[model samples]
Target: MKLYTYFRSSAAYRVRIALNLKGLSYDAIPVHLTRTGGEHRQEGYTAINPAALVPALVDETRVLTQSMAIIEYLDETHPEPALLPGSALDRARIRAIAQAIACDIHPINNLRVLQYLGRELGASEEQKNAWYRHWVELGLQAVEAMLADDARTGAFCHGDTPTLADCCLVPQVFNARRFNCRMEAFPTINRIVDRCEAMEPFRLAAPSNQADAE
Candidate 1:
């Protein structure tokens, strides 16, 4: 197995955490997202993933794109340490939390979107960063409510054991810290992220720990 990844990408970070949690070993192929003109846009990489996204997983038979899909695939194929374990309702809740971060929060603050804000919309660096912080703060506030109001949120996002939601939450929190977003408002999020970072899988998957990190 091999993973095409960018060190700072939160989406790729999600896949890395999931792989580590499953105890799956794979080669990490660093794809520079902003060297020259972005390696992911190059023909070679695009041939592998037409969407030109990071965290594309190539197993023996197929190549998978999208972090959440790849994570579910891993969980399905190697079911021992299930990423989304429990009843159907429990699973749905876990997925909802994960998507709250992965879908609603992440896409708006992604690298390409920020670049578009600066290059196309003529936004200054300050403006672009403000845009990033706004969405993150708003989204995390909602996540804080979701986690704090629910009894299901435990050591991790879903329960005592880390689940799919924890995998998604840790990376988003990392990005929030990177952008200097105010985190004190979300005490529950900070507590959950602290617990996750203490675990080996999350520690090893952190952007700073990756081989491609600057």
Candidate 2:
């Protein structure tokens, strides 16, 4: 198996954590996202993933894209330590939490989106950062409320075991810290991230631990 990744991509980071949790080893193919106007944009990468996204997983000859789909595939293929919870409602809740960060927060502030805001929309760096922080804080606040309101949230996001929510949360926290987003209000997020960081899998899969880390 092989995993193509970018060092700081939160989407890729989520996949990294999922792969580690499953105890799956793969060739770490580092795809430099920003070396020369983004490696993901190159034809070779686009052939693997027409979306031009980071984290395209190759097992045997099959290449899979999208972090959530890859994670579900991993869970299905390797069910020893399941990354999802039991029951339909529990699964829905876990997916909701993950998507709260992955869809709501991430897409709006992606590197390409930020670049578009600056180059096409005439947004300054300061404005762009503020825009990023705004969505992150808003989304995180909602997640905090959801967790605080629910009894299912434990050391991890979904019960005592780390599930898909935890997988998504830790990477978003990494991105939050990188962008200097204030984390004081989101105590649950910080706690989960701390728990995840203590594990070797999360530690080794960190952006700084990557081969192409700057």
TM-score of 1: 0.99
**Model 2, global lDDT:** 0.89
Please give each candidate's TM-score: 0.99, 0.98
lDDT of residue 33 for candidate 1: 96
Tell me the tens digit of each residue's lDDT in model 2 across 1-214: 8999988988888889888988999888888888899888999899999999989999999999999999999999999688886899999999999999889888898999999999999999899989999999999999998888899889889898889888888888888888999999998888888998999888888899988899
lDDT of 1 by residue, 108-147 (tens): 9998999999989999999998999999999999999999
Q: Could you say which candidate leads in TM-score?
A: 1
**Structure candidate 2, residue pairs in collision:** none
